[model samples]
Target chain A: MKTYTRPLDLKNGRVDMSHGSGGRAMAQLIDELFARHFTNPILAEQGDGACFALPVGAGKMVMATDSHVVSPLFFAGGDIGCLSVHGTINDVAMMGAKPLYLSAAFILEEGFPLADLLRIVQSMAQAAREAGVPIVTGDTKVVEAGKGDGVFITTTGIGVVAEGIDLKPSNIKVGDKILVSGMLGDHGVAIMSQRENLTFETTIQSDTAALNGLVATMLDAVPNIHALRDPTRGGLAAVLNEFAQASGHGMLIHEKAIPVRSQVAAACELLGLDPLYVANEGKLVAYCAAEDAETLLAAMRAHPLGRDAAIIGEVIADTNAFVQMETVFGGRRMVDWINGEQLPRIC
Target chain B: MKTYTRPLDLKNGRVDMSHGSGGRAMAQLIDELFARHFTNPILAEQGDGACFALPVGAGKMVMATDSHVVSPLFFAGGDIGCLSVHGTINDVAMMGAKPLYLSAAFILEEGFPLADLLRIVQSMAQAAREAGVPIVTGDTKVVEAGKGDGVFITTTGIGVVAEGIDLKPSNIKVGDKILVSGMLGDHGVAIMSQRENLTFETTIQSDTAALNGLVATMLDAVPNIHALRDPTRGGLAAVLNEFAQASGHGMLIHEKAIPVRSQVAAACELLGLDPLYVANEGKLVAYCAAEDAETLLAAMRAHPLGRDAAIIGEVIADTNAFVQMETVFGGRRMVDWINGEQLPRIC
Candidate 1:
């Protein structure tokens, strides 16, 4: 048996071609570093690919993929590792499904610190465990230094949705109630502050989280929910506009009802940003029947992940399919769709 | 009817924040640029997202996502636009499925040319239509100039695999015949020739193509194929090594049995690159039972896209899981996995 207690020389060492050479050096690195940290039955098999049995079911499977390329790999609350897992898992959950397996492909830049890679892989493993999702299959490729940033992660998730539950944007109807899971703009603001070298008296942490539990609760309360969307990149306003346009209906959101933490609001105000258009990693937007709105809100609030849940808007019949918001002072304005990238490289 | 055409000053125009600000300018850009080129029933609906009915099926659905960030957006044989669509569609098809729909997300640099963007979008539409896949839903964001390369495309594809087709690496066994779809190194050599400013008497064009049609033919001929893989980034050697390790088998490939174009070979030689390890955009590696090999090979050769198909190797029981080649000169050497990203951003 080989003793494996050596500390990784993360500081001085740089990733070389050998790391991807598919030789003894590559195998050793995988065994001593990645495999050790991401230990699981499937990954430990040490095969070129993972093989496992899928649960027997007639349910429809939902799959989604997302790539993470946020600058400054490490952020206030999460790094690219955790973001990679969270982003794809959220995408799968948004389809009203239970996420099962995840496949990750890493594009690593040569000269990247091995210790840093270990940390990221470990974080991804931890996130997967917490989300109750397995990292089943993966690929790793190292690009030369100048050709890549520190790291880029592309994650694909597969999930199964039980029959009789067909969720679609077209399912939304006039008078549908819209509810938000929690505070907005935290993740976007936290990343921006770190990247722009801005600081405030009160620290802002990213709301990077897995929302499958919250989704499960919402589904339990209202099985026929119209639609579920995670307001990630382009935030609340963008999601609402998307829903309205997709369903061919207008939306009326109450600005006072949408949740935004004070710190996020302050940061946005100082930076001349709109919290509504910023990103949120942990939060979700759910549209349901007005009759089931309270039941859904209560269920969301009951979950730890959705403590700040609130009824933010309602759907309306309009060919224009506009998304309008009632201001805190009672003025109505359009909460339009975002046209371009908000904060580039935002996961 | 309104008639309108404008000369685009790509060099002088700079994108302001309003381009993504969800205002009139954003709407105009989308209508005049993106929507114009990507005109289709699903996209023309102008919904925040797309809604369409899936073909009736109890078949399993396969989905894959890929991000394209190749430099010199327009390459030797294809641009980043078509590459994005082709890459993900091939990923889904490699599972022995018929690709259905695609979703694209664009991250455009602030100063990128609208005309260039339109050209790319047109190419994407053409490729998607040619591949029999629809671009259903998409998201676009513009990053500030220094924050990103000119453009990055992330494409997601969804496909449906027929019933009873169980393809997996675990299905691979000793004595399994290995097949290469067509010529190798065309894509890598073409891109490198352009990148390195190397000129040759014969211009090397990339073999960038959609392989779903070829896959369907092979599947119809030999339904019990063990595994199918595309030799893309790290190329034939990487994929073969992966399959060998996954199946716990060694491989013996005859160099003469592999197909390569003369120009590609010359380009690789000049660059001191191995054709075995160089990428091929439209090629595949199929491992199947020896009994079905002839049928599969005939089917592949019949396809216009796979006229150069060849039975290159066979799987052998070995704990080492090595990939070895029998050279044309009767010499034996290892055909190992790639060490690093060969020709970064080629795809």
Candidate 2:
């Protein structure tokens, strides 16, 4: 039975096994870190699960989940905290749904620095608040040292689409156009640069940002959008290849039209990698009819996240459903689905 | 190009970093393990997110999430997989909701055996099927060796409660009767037995099972149940204490009336642990009107999950809101919320 008037030791303290023990220490940590940062009415209720009132006709609800095990924990543009929130939010937005709420589950390693843990938690809160979503519920666990990294976050997002909006790859037609929101490979390169033994990076920060606002703006201009996808894990190439197979249409792209930052491009060259197949955290790819492409591009360009947007490719009729990319030197090469892992733990 | 006409090497294979690379290896792992087991219509669509149609007036939806980081991977009666699914399902059911779907995310260690991973996945699929819920979406990540345990899973569940059903600790009244579903301390003992340095002989095993159906059956019998909770992390003592504080009332319970297996009781005695504070994975405590207590007990006893249901406690009016317990030796003691962690990583 003791009381003290000192703040939590987040500067030089480490998370021991007791922080996640579901007792006084765990409750104290939650109160000082999670509850203080994620201050919303729903989360404040602090029940076993969060409760919310859904409107009568909110239409289809979409759920997406992603586990962030990114190396280095912190990167140039963002850390695992914000990346976890942004990743799942983008997944929900790909369905043309308004991201509504999120749940975060953290697995912390024993003896991890408490200061770093608080930093990540605040970053997640900031990201969720910026996107107008709340971390309504969460769970935390701690494993034995060496049994886990500093922390791994699994974020699950729930969103609701209006009654009339339908976005799916099956809606792609032969003459549809493809566009990307911004440059690719920055997020991946930023992490690779910080990895052990890799050291060639020149201001190639991660393009990690929540793209739900951009999606909403695009929908405002083109409600009849065909398909939308975030070029995340396998970059623009992975998303485009999936779209081709899902839609049963061939895709032809001009490599010169694709956006790639000069620094990231130089780094890819030094590492003998393909920027087209690298990862992105904030960019998106959209497929729409030829008539709506210009208007959608204009709308996307107006958004800060999609300023460098361009129509990079078009859908075509082909029985083989190949994703063909015209090289900058004028030869066409088949951009096949990656055979193995291009980049490990890219997201 | 190498194609092997054989199944994946679940027995002898180790998970490399490539398994989580979001490329061909990752897709193969999903197809071979996760998709093959969690076969449902919505999951087969394989979009970035899972979309579901919500009826117009389906009432309030409840979402719950939990991360399982149990040590020793496999324990008596259940492993992390079944535990994860049961844990989240019970959370939603505690709100008197019927679980509809679940999403799982896995973080695996780089060099963990593939066999263990598959076993956990299949167990999860079995648990979901038994609960009549589907695993509609999932994500997987792998960390470096020594950066993770064998695996950690986070399961998030969504459930919908019918109109006119309300269950909350806030509803408890002074004369309300408290009922427990079944035995306690078995699960905690079972886990402790398998810890690195602990060993004992006992038939007490982890009581990991889905309780949504039991919740439904009880609702059919007594729709006016005031409160519901599963004694998982801090056990029955923790739950009753929470109820007493939340309802602004005191609680009185008889130690002799509580159900505990003799073997489990012996284990607790040997381990110097109290049965009231040990966790139970598949038990529930219900608060209801004193007049309806017997009928509700009868209804619960008819269900397998609650065969040993007993009325063990009652709510009382006390300004201090203390949980007073009457021991078998005819002595009274105050059971307070645990101060520090009673048990670390007990769940």
Q: Which docking category, incorrect, acceptable, medium or high, applies to candidate 1?
A: incorrect
Task: Tell how far residue A39 is off in model 1, in angstroms.
Answer: 6.1
List the pairs of residues colliding in candidate 1. A340-B141, A341-B141, A341-B142
* Candidate 1 chain B weakest lDDT stretch, 10 residues: B1-10
**What are the models' TM-scores?**
0.84, 0.96
> In model 2 chain A, where is the ten-residue run with the lowest total lDDT?
A1-10
lDDT of 1 at A12: 66
| Clashes found in each candidate (C-alpha, N, C closer than 3 A) | 3, 2
Question: Tens digits of per-residue lDDT for model 1 on A75-137?
Answer: 889999998899888877888887877767666667888878878988999999999997765
Report how far off residue A306 is in candidate 2 (Å): 0.9
Chain B TM-score for the candidates in order: 0.93, 0.97
Which clashing pairs does model 2 show?
A147-B148, A147-B149
Q: lDDT tens string, model 1, B1-347? A: 11224533444665554555443345566666667677787676553344444446536656566667766688778988998888888887887778877767666667777768877888998999899898865655555565556777777776677878867777889999999999999888877767645555347788889998899999989999988988887788888877777777899999999998887787788788889988788989999999999999999999998899999999988788889999999999998765444566666
- List runs of model 1 lying over 4 Å from the truth: A1-12, A15-65, A137-148, A158-160, A166-174, A244-250, A315-345, B1-65, B137-143, B158-164, B169-174, B199-201, B316-319, B338-342
Best by DockQ: 2
Which whole-number lDDT from 0 to 100 does residue A267 have in model 1? 90
Error of 2 at B139 (Å): 0.3
